[model samples]
Target: MQIQGLHHAQITIPKGREQEGRQFYCELLGLEEMEKPEALKGRGGFWLHAGNLQVHVGTEDGDARSATKAHLAYEVTGLEAWKETLRAQGLVPEESVPVPGMERFEFRDPFGNRVELLEVTEDPSL
Candidate 1:
């Protein structure tokens, strides 16, 4: 048997700072907050669903550095509209880059988390 797909993803936020995480991931990014399992709630974490993947944010012991190198990429249909929406929320969207087979733009979340928005187009050679 082979691995099918990713079930969940976890991001670390400093202890007692989940509000900031919620503001960015939930409010700004438009992800809906979901309740964590009762067993895992004691650890202080929240879950959100994106498409079919689950994103988990857990509180860490101390001041944790932001993950700039790693990022979550989201594919959207209305790329321009999304860019405008981000700008209206005071989040700047960088110019789209040609990724050989896709179009993408990079933006940072309120917590300085790097995220990429991508839209795939029909291959010219197809």
Candidate 2:
């Protein structure tokens, strides 16, 4: 199975500064704010459209961006096949927080950066 492309990349801002994050990314950068999933609404963060992909801005207590839970999400065609592939490579994939219409897992890369593989089961925007 092949990865289709990047679905989204995440970055984090300091906790309780969501409004500043929105003003910077949405107003200054001109990215349209996208609705976060209903289940995730209470989580203090936001999502933005960046051309064909998305950028998810989350909150963190303190640290450099990479030290937080920021990650890159890649869209893949085969959900189960990817799990098998990662397992064969000896990497344990951790189940992600459930998002409606998507199946996903996260694993740390060799250098310790978080990477997520996701397959869309339905159009989440619908």
Best lDDT goes to which candidate?
1
| lDDT (10s digit) by residue, model 1, range 1-126 | 999999988877777778888887888678989888889888886999988999888777642335456877887778888889899988889865577777789887765667889887766587
lDDT of each: 0.79, 0.75
| TM accuracy, model 1 | 0.79
Instruction: TM-score each candidate.
Output: 0.79, 0.51
Residue-level error in angstroms, candidate 2, position 61: 0.8
How well is each residue in 1-126 modelled by candidate 2, as lDDT tens digits?
999997887776777888876765566335799999999988889998876998887777755554647677767778788778768767678999999899999876433446788889998779
Q: How many steric overlaps does candidate 1 have?
A: 0
How does residue 89 of candidate 2 score in lDDT? 61
